[model samples]
Target chain A: MQDPFELSPSECEALLRAGVVGRIALATPTGPHIVPVNYSVVEESIVVLTSPYSLLGTHGRDSMLAFEIDQFDYEYHRGWSVVARGRAEVVTDPAEVERIRKTWPPRPWASGIRTLCLRIRWSELSGRRLGTGWQPMEDLPVHRVV
Target chain B: MQDPFELSPSECEALLRAGVVGRIALATPTGPHIVPVNYSVVEESIVVLTSPYSLLGTHGRDSMLAFEIDQFDYEYHRGWSVVARGRAEVVTDPAEVERIRKTWPPRPWASGIRTLCLRIRWSELSGRRLGTGWQPMEDLPVHRVV
Candidate 1:
């Protein structure tokens, strides 16, 4: 049985950049909520488009959050997972938000008027890969590319 | 533009039963953590095998948690997501654990001892499907089958 290995910072960043969909965990008064989101890596930060009135958009601001992206092959039982722990902030500055949108605009799969942009300024980045040996990223199937 | 619809209890349970992998959200003192896990549904409870010393297993006991399973199609831009929120408990009963093991044992892709069996007794079950029209279950690709 092969053991899971730690991924280096560069490897983790590459995976994060390649990923288009991820789950964001937020702490709420009711409990911890995990919601899938479409994201883009912008200037070493994760940015997503959401509604300001939505639960995540409202409660996520200035709160600690965890963002995760992973790809798993069930047939081979091999996968890689990356987690980013950070504080979320709402991008309210019109110029800043427009600049980010121009560079890395988040196109959410779910149809909605996602006008507010939320950014997660990650403090810790960690990842793990489950397999025998690491292979070139190009060899793997690109599941989602946004 | 399509609207997201609420899923019925039966639909949510069916999706849970069909899923083989899910993400569990745990609130830690430092921050909220989200991690992928292999899980099975037994008696309407989500069961997973994890190491007692691991971050999730150690801090998940009796804590409010969220379990999420989802399938998304990038080409079609449609998907369904289910979230189960409840308190997590360690299954210490030998008989019950043995029964769960025999019924639907979790096969973790990541190598670990994973002796502790954690169960989430969900108090709230909610789901949403992003699309214009709902189709039959068989029409959708079964990404995860337990």
Candidate 2:
């Protein structure tokens, strides 16, 4: 694939490690709505916590899931999107959670216990970005601009 | 209402008229997701082009919808959020859309007629903003950041 956003594996890991904030994507009966989540980065996977009543907990966990984390520099017109696609499930055992908690601590948002951590386990993790050195907008024809 | 960042009716009209890109939120089967959509202000509402299979069309149109447009200066921490809360419906009549097309042209992203323009009837519109003061992170506790 002649993809422009060719980022190195280490670079991908760095962006994933940058922070725990990301947008959780899923479908609901009424429609799709997005919410910010404070996440924990664990062994090549992104984990999020939610309660049973949470929409995601209701529709997603144990179902197909994807987690996206990115950073954008507007002045430079460059950004990268890294998504992990896999299954989501509820973590019920406290001992298992305690074992994972030492390394990946669960953080809370203003939202609500509806927080169930989703683990996206996939190896096809990669990213794309808009590089520099584009011609100025002034050089384009009126029709081209359109 | 001691609202700090309220825009006048005309200002709100202009914001929608300016054709600033708006964020579209849709509920997906996996979870809720958000993406950028180019739109124009029409007849006191915000409109965007979407496909029939698009999440919004499948689960959102004619259902409760929420559209948000924001102008934020991250460096300055002074910005505004305009939220449109209402139901969305697909425009079926050609004449009503023809009236809309005169001002708001449709620029479809993907190639397909399955994608139609959705008019977000936002009768309950409201806005709020952050002040231009440098409130140190230290001054406010973690729970107050929200």
Candidate 3:
């Protein structure tokens, strides 16, 4: 893809809605940490539920973080991904909780937890799609101009 | 919480053995690509079974790549990960295959056709454990300082 690094806003939105699994990258005291998490694509941000006693729960609020969603169809050898860099914080308002609850029903993944509402502050969003092979940036097809 | 970077070798070994899933990062002609696969720990190296037509079958042999395994336990806010980086290649010997197969099933994951045998040439192994709270590297206890 020519523009493999850049993704259309509409495409980015579609990718986010396609699934709830993504990799979350956060900065701990020592270094960077990444973990696969199930998240909801809300508005322009990605939301996840976890125990409130967790480190990411409190330190993540308004803190710089990144969420990545990508799918690689090995059979067809094609996939796209989106990376969202923003601040994160816990969602506490009752009305907001109601809104999120309406779409996300009680699931088995979270087991039985009530206080795991966390939202990522949306910032810059971007992504890319892989083309034929690992061609150089200048050699990709014309349609893939990033 | 200390040693956020996964500094302990034992922790690394445990993560590799305890978890049966991991993502393999490879350098394809297109660029860096990642795929989720099931693997078993063998002599400290991560071994995976793939199909002859799969990417691992094509590039896993003698190809330098990265193997990553990590787990996040949200309840205790504890998790550990181990990453092994080196060359990967196919093992064709029946005796070698039997040895590894005895330790682990021929097919490790829930999906995929298991005919390709891959052994990562583990050059360096390292790991870190995440504690409930974030702590600096210096605060972490040193064990078997590699």
My TM-score estimates for the predictions, one after another, are 0.92, 0.54, 0.48
Give per-residue CA lDDT, model 2, range A1-146, as digits (tens).
11144567676666666655565655555444443455677777777777777666787676655566554433343445565556666776787677668877645433344446566664455554444444222221111000
DockQ of 3: 0.04
Please list the residue runs of candidate 3 whose C-alpha ends up more than 4 Å from where it truly belongs after superposition.
A1-146, B1-5, B74-78, B133-146
Give the per-residue lDDT digits (tens) of candidate 3, residues A1-146: 12234568677766666554566655545333455555776676678877766656655556676676654433434445676767787788989888877865222233335377778866767776654454222221211101
lDDT of each: 0.84, 0.56, 0.59
Report the C-alpha lDDT of model 2 over B11-81, residue by residue, as the tens digit: 55555555445556554554444545556667767777877786666866776665655543333334454
TM-score-better candidate, 1 vs 2: 1
- Model 1 clash tally? 0
Off by over 4 Å in 1: A133-136, A139-146, B133-136, B139-146
Residue A127 CA error for candidate 3 (Å)? 15
Candidate 3 chain A: 10-residue stretch with minimal lDDT: A137-146
The fraction of reference A/B contacts recovered in model 3 reads: 0.00
Per residue, candidate 1 scores C-alpha lDDT tens digits across A13-81 of 888887778899999899999888988989879999889888788778899999998777667777788
* Cα error, candidate 3, residue B109 (Å): 3.2
Task: Give the TM-score, chain B only, in order for the candidates.
Answer: 0.92, 0.74, 0.76
What is the C-alpha lDDT profile of model 3 across B9-128, one tens digit per residue?
665565556655566656444333455565676785778888788766775567776666654443444555566777777878999889987876433423446688888766766775
